[model samples]
Target: MYGHGYTQPVKPPPPAGLLVLLRVLFLGIAVFSIGFMAWAPLLRLAIVTRKSLDWGLFVAAMAADVLSIVLLGSEPGEDVRTAGGYLGITLLLGTLAVGSVYYLAADIRHFHQLRYPAYPVGQPRAAAYGYPQAPTPVPAPYTAPNPRQTPPPMPRTPAPQPPANTPPPRPPQRPAPARIDQVRAELDELSDYLRKHDEGGR
Candidate 1:
């Protein structure tokens, strides 16, 4: 989007019939200054008849006018009176050339504006040139996916078991010591064997 500061070149209105007539008069003077050059006369004729000037003819005419000026200015030395007359003629031709150039430039600008006018910023340019305005494209609306088209569900993970539900580990057991009764029984047997030996000796 362009800001309010943006501006378009406003085309000047077309020249009226009187203005066109004046242009023709100036163009004729230019053509005369160029010694009635062929292309200049043809271009002038086209203008008078309300026809577009041919690009080739326009170029040729301008070239001929420039050549004419160069040739006239490059003449050999002459008397003071002749030089004065040449200077006056040169000035007149120069004026005519300037006028003709301005007139052609205006005409070309007008034609271009007619064919392709500048519209204001943010405005439709095709409308200015008498073309139909094109429709603005709209994006399509979004929609939710159908249940039948949905993807399969992912596999579920198992939950971890709580510590309280697990069994406790048992403590390590030590080996049992010898019994006192067994020790006493061994001592009694030894005493009995000694007594029987003593009796046998007596």
Candidate 2:
């Protein structure tokens, strides 16, 4: 994940080297076939350099051609009287064997250049485009403070008092005494009412 305003570009994959692998495979197969299909390595190398031929591979293929020609022209066999006799065929096959090895090596080198490049390709894309920038504001010049006019003292805040954990115990008042006084007054009035009723009855 990217952090707040920054963006990261996706990573690109490296080269596969499939052409180099194919050339090697053909060379391996030609080895087992005893030079019967030696032209396969050349075909693979040609296809690999079709777009832009590498100087190394080009030189290797040219060398292989010249070596094969020299082997065919100079040797004579025990049975044949022609220029490329049985001994010549053997030497030509040996040249083909060598060609398979070097061609594979050259193709590997060419494909390697694709992955690990030689030139300077790391230039930034946005280096040339200049964006419009806001002009900076000029800072005001500083002035010394006057010593004659002293600055007013800052107001001090009162420190808060710590609250008491437990409150003082208040004197307990007897509510039952007041209630009994009220009942006594009501009982006197009730007795007087009973005496008046009795006199009225007599």
Candidate 3:
């Protein structure tokens, strides 16, 4: 789901170690070519007897060497022993190194192209390397409901009504207060009894 938008099947990349090895190999080849070219006689011999080695490899190496020389030749100098030699050697080496880097990048791109060509439009890419290919689901076709045969409506429940003779609910009543006059009469009776008892004793 994270990369759902990437409908194109992910192309497995070349092994990292393999790629790194290839880059190093190319650089080594480029260096060997530069060294071979530095001495003009050997380069001439190689060109003359190209059939002695793998024709493709020899030609590519030669081309790389010549191109580096050409790039170096652009710099102004007097003689090979002076600034000319230094500049030429420096430029030639730099050109070869840069070319090697470029070649490495190009070779990687070429490998990718060979491995993964453009996927055809509309056709989903085949799932490989543990990736699951989910099929696009088709939706069901729509149909109108039958006009003559409709489902019966649900029954409705009526609310309950109170009886007409039922009395209305009354408010709660408060407790009655104690009578002050009754309390005073009790206190006076108690005092009179006590007073008569005390007088009889004396």
Models 1 onward score TM values of 0.26, 0.35, 0.30
Q: How accurate is candidate 2 locally (lDDT)?
A: 0.64
Best by TM-score: 2
- Cα RMSDs, all models: 22.4, 20.1, 19.4
1 against 2, candidate with superior TM-score? 2
Give the number of the best model, judged by lDDT.
2
Task: Give candidate 1 misplaced runs (Cα > 4 Å).
Answer: 1-29, 33-83, 120-202
Model 3: runs farther than 4 Å from truth?
Answer: 1-19, 31-81, 119-202
Kindly give the number of clashing pairs for every candidate: 0, 0, 0
lDDT of each: 0.59, 0.64, 0.59
Whichever of 1 and 3 has more TM-score, that candidate is 3
User: How well is each residue in 1-202 modelled by candidate 2, as lDDT tens digits?
Assistant: 5535646863443346655466558878667755645656766667666644444444555465555556556655434566555555565577566767767676767667765656434443333235654444555788999999989999999998657996767899878988999999999999999999999999
lDDT of 3 by residue, 127-192 (tens): 775678886455577888898987899898988877889987899975545566677789999999
Lowest-sum lDDT 10-residue window in model 2: 120-129
Worst 10 residues of 3 by lDDT: 36-45
Write candidate 1's Cα lDDT for 10-104 as tens digits. Answer: 55655566556756665665576454343453365356435454454556556655665565556655432455447645654664565466557
